[model samples]
Target: MIAVLFAILTAFSNGSASVLQRRAALEVPHTDAVGMSLIGHLLRQKVWLAGIGLVIVAAVCQAVALATGPISVVQPIFVIELPATLLLAGFMMRAPLPRPVWLGVAAVTLGLALGMASAAPGGGSSAVHGAAWVPALILTGLVETLLIAGGLATRGNVRAALLATAAACAYALTAALMKDAMARLDGGGGAGALFTSWQLYATAAAGVGALFLLQNALQAGTLVAVQPCLTLGDALISVLYGVTLFGEDLRTGWWVLPELLALGLIAAGCVELARSPLASGNATAPARARRVD
Candidate 1:
């Protein structure tokens, strides 16, 4: 339960950060899709800095959640970020969420709850085998590179989705590595031991890469184009990592139906929410138009 609370907080912090960062990214001009110059420009913006702060908070919460719970459990919880981001974006834009949007929100909430309850994921070893490290990192790097290349080759929403997918992969890898690092920390390995562990550094590197890709995604297109890809891709890939790398397992048989149904609800809700006017990040009315009598 404590881990669930931390994961919820992580979602809120990350969702808020995404909105702030996206807003800031759009305000700046970019010469290239994934250039360092764009990140440097974003770094100068106060709003982007604020977003980075929230990202740090989110990272802390995520770390605690991963340390205390299975990745299968914690990663699915991140799907909440989509609705949370939509809400924050709507509030920031001073746009009221419509009835259908509310319905989508409810669906996501209920589906996530049902899915988690039905999955009943079992705990697993946090520390992955030393031999698994090289292959896992290599595969993750290759996938990220491919996604980034594909994103750079495209334009508009397609590009954003690709970049967000790449970012999701990086984040998923980061969480897996962080879980390993946390496990090491708790295994009587003093704080200094983290410095010697490759997982710590790898997590940092992946996290930075993920942040860069995310900012690019935000700049490439609207949140509607980016959020769903990031939200879903990360969750699914993290579940795979939890199962393959950490040996976690979920409930079987009768529970499979609810979990599948829950995924459908989540998918439906994500699509609906992403198609809503207010979620477009450009549908906000003018300041005076928002003034109530």
Candidate 2:
């Protein structure tokens, strides 16, 4: 329950960060995509810095959540990030959300609840066993590489989706690594052990890489294209990592039906919410127009 609360807080913080970062990314030149120049340009933007600050806060929340509960339980709750993002965007734009948007939010909320209840993810270890990280890291690297290559080979929404997927995978990996590092502390290891863990450094590296990919994704296309992939991919991938690497238990057999249904609802809701004007940065246009008028 404590983990759930922190996870929800992390989702909201991340959602808010996404909106601010997306806005800042849109102002950067497309030519700077996937390069140091992009970071250089973003550093000049106060909005992006504010977003980064929120991201740091989210990270702290996420670390706490992972330390307290199973990664499977902690990570899947982030599916709400999409709905949260749209809601925050609507608030920021001072736009009244339409019926479809509200319905989308309901679907996502209901689906997440149903899914978590049905799956009941638990029985995960706080630390991963030896030699497990080797195979997992290799497979994750290959998958992320393919996604990045495909993203680079595409344009527009295709590029955005692929890049966002890669970012999602990186973020999931970061969570897993963070959980392992936090375990050192939970297992009676002091700050020296925690700081010295390779997982700690890897987590930092993965997080920075994910942030870069996310920036490029935001620049590549509309939030309509990026948000769904980012939110859904992160949730799914994190669950996989939790189950496989962390030995988390999820219900099987008859429970698969509701779990499948839950995923469908979540996916459908994400698509619908992503299509909203608020999510796509269009809601502010009317506000600006009214101001002009």
Q: Who wins the TM-score comparison?
A: 2
Query: What's model 2's TM-score?
Result: 0.84
Model 2: which residue pairs collide? Answer: none
Candidate with the greatest lDDT versus the true structure: 2
User: For each candidate, what TM-score against the reference?
Assistant: 0.79, 0.84
Q: Model 2, residue 100: displacement in angstroms?
A: 1.5
What is the RMSD, in Å, between candidate 1 and the native fold over all Cα? 6.2
In model 1, pairs of residues that clash are none
> What is the TM-score (0 to 1) of candidate 1?
0.79
Per-residue lDDT tens digits for candidate 2, residues 119-152, read: 9899879999989999999999999999999999
Q: How does residue 192 of candidate 1 score in lDDT?
A: 76
lDDT tens digits, residue span 103-222, model 1: 888988998899888988867887797588788778888988899999999999999999988888888888898888988778797787877888889888888888888889978986
Per-model lDDT: 0.79, 0.83
